[model samples]
Target: MIGTLLTFLAVGIVSIVVVWIVLSVVGSLLGLTMTIATFLLFKVAPVMFLGWAALKLWAWARNNRGFLSAKDRRWLERE
Candidate 1:
């Protein structure tokens, strides 16, 4: 009876340790993926999107006068 109880205790401890390791590894991977995705969304996406929008607006204003001030039009052309 004593041997059986000791074996059960050992198995339980081993199972707990295995579970903890698996959880930690998976959690770290998920955290890294989330961090990279967040960086791209907040840092890179806005810069690319805003740059594209500015170019499109400049083109539209150049073709359609009176849409933007003469000074603003000159600035766009200068750039």
Candidate 2:
């Protein structure tokens, strides 16, 4: 009876350890996925905003006459 109880206890400990390891692995994977998703968003958002701004400026230039004053044109030309 004592031997049987010891065996059961060992098995239960092993089972708990296995469950803990699996949960740890899953948690690490979820953390890594979120990190990659956030990194991609940070990297792409600025480029997207800049592209949008450029498109808007191009459209405005095409539709408007003398959008910039002469001083602004001179400043732009100097740059």
Q: Give the top-scoring candidate (TM-score).
A: 1
Off by over 4 Å in 1: 58-79
Mind giving the per-residue lDDT tens digits that candidate 2 earns over 1-79? 9999999999999999999999999999999999999987898888998999999999898758757778888999998
Number of colliding residue pairs in model 1: 0
For model 1, residues 1-79, the per-residue Cα lDDT tens digits are 9999999999999999999999999999999999999999999999999999999998888778756778977999998
- Give the runs in model 2 whose Cα sits over 4 Å from its true position: 63-79
lDDT of 1: 0.95
Highest lDDT model number: 1
Q: Which window of 10 residues has the lowest lDDT sum in candidate 2?
A: 61-70
Minimum summed lDDT over a 10-residue window in model 1 is located at 61-70
